[model samples]
Target: MALSVIGAGFGRTGTLSLKFALEQLGLSPCHHMMEVFANPEQAPVWLSAARGETVDWDSLLSGYKASVDWPSCHFWRELAAHYPEAKVILSTRDPQQWYKSISGTIFPAMAGGLPEEGPQRDMLTMVRHIVSDKVFSGATDQAHVLDVLARHEAEVKRSIPAERLLVFDVAESWEPLCRFLGVPVPDTPFPRTNSSEEFQARLS
Candidate 1:
């Protein structure tokens, strides 16, 4: 199935929660970085894409109705063009908090190397190429990283048609998202997950 929702937001910007929220809104099978970790077969395909090679987006993302966060977010432009009908979600947060969250969670995680070679290792490698090098330009300084985040958000807003994009913050919850997708808001509370502490605990 083709993607109906494409997330242009970087990781640590409430993407994990957005994944669940989207699924709850009937967009199940949302793709996230964690999906690659859970499925080894998907790693190499992403690694290939990370290296700047053209890929069959459909084959790679087959069965997924939506995508969010890293790896996918890194290729948002391509995915947007490929799935023209898909609406873009630019998930965001306070700039300083976004920096702090990534600093505490994903930054150190990607800085370390896996002990042995495997699919997960390959996945980390792809992430490093995309997140560490390409996205952040290999600089983790507060100034630089925050700048990248701001520029990314601005670019998404500029490139995607205003009508087709929703600048979302998970804190705002389901109404905005539900309204954007033309779906009824669930009676259930929005999914709020993957906080910095939880992310650190998982890595530990």
Candidate 2:
């Protein structure tokens, strides 16, 4: 299936919640980093992409209707171009809060104990190449990270047509998202999940 929605946001920006929200909106089986973990075969593909190699996007994401978070989000431009009809969602949050969330959740986790070989290691290395190395330039300083996010948000805005993009914060819940995607707001509450506390708990 072609991707109907492309998440252009970095990780730790309510991406997990957005994944579930999109699924509930009928974009079921949304692809996220979690999908990569569950599908180890995908790690090599992503690692290739991280190293500037080309792969068939259609085959790689064949069954996914939407994708959020990393690995995919890093390829938003290519995906958007490949699937010209797809809408882009630029998920965002307060800079300070975003930095704090990643510091506690993603940064440490990436640096923590990881398998020495195989798919898990490939995934972690791919993540490092994409986020820590490329995006942040190997700097985790608050000011630099915030600047990168601001520039990334601006780049997405400039690259995508205004009508085709939604600068979303999950805290805003369903209204703007539903309106952007032209889907009815569901009766159930929006998903709220994968908080820093939850992430830390998972590591323990």
Candidate 3:
């Protein structure tokens, strides 16, 4: 397969919008946590992958040309191992704003609702398992959240080739992304999504 795209961004980082944009750009068959939401059956498959247990990559990667958000984010290091040549996108936003958005809405929405057998459930489990390590830097505080972003940034820089790793801020629009991906720039504003209110309402 050609180089696939992986979103290393956490939830609430405009990953959904990016997923849609990539699809519009001809990167179809992408995977996202929302896919897990819509299809609960993929949970166990994701759980095994996140735990570094054996999984059928051919079957798993068969349908998706790209993957974003949780579970995918959780297993990025693993994905890097599998698709060593795949492009990695590190989506970022201001740390405080991200924390506010996540704490207020995203986390609340997913709590206690993921299916035990499906991918969504597996994502919830995987995220919780790694939040302290990946998103919180083994600590839980406002400072820790910032630390997570910083550490993740550093890790990606160290692990992936500079050319293979792209740092994209959703607010910056498509030009930079298009340039990096070698896709023609679409004549449209980058899609902005997942307001705090919208995320909060999902919880209800």
Which candidate tops TM-score? 1
Give me the runs in candidate 3 sitting further than 4 Å from their true place: 1-3, 110-127, 130-140
Off by over 4 Å in 1: none
Model 3 residue 98 CA deviation in Å: 0.8
Tens-digit lDDT track of model 1 for 24-67: 88889999988888886887888788788889999999999999
User: What C-alpha lDDT do the candidate models reach, one value each?
Assistant: 0.92, 0.92, 0.73
Q: Worst ten-residue run, lDDT, model 2?
A: 105-114
Q: What RMSD does each model have against the real structure?
A: 0.9, 1.1, 2.8
lDDT-based ranking, best first? 2, 1, 3
Compose the digit string of candidate 3's lDDT tens values, residues 1-204: 433888788777778788888887778867887787777667668667756689876576676878878767766777877887689998887878888877776555545555756455566775555554445544556676667777877787788788988888878888878888899989877776668886667656
lDDT of each residue in 147-199, candidate 2, tens digit only: 99999999999999999999999999999999999989999999999999988
Preferred candidate (lDDT higher): 2 or 3: 2
Task: Give the Cα-based TM-score of candidate 2 against the true structure.
Answer: 0.97
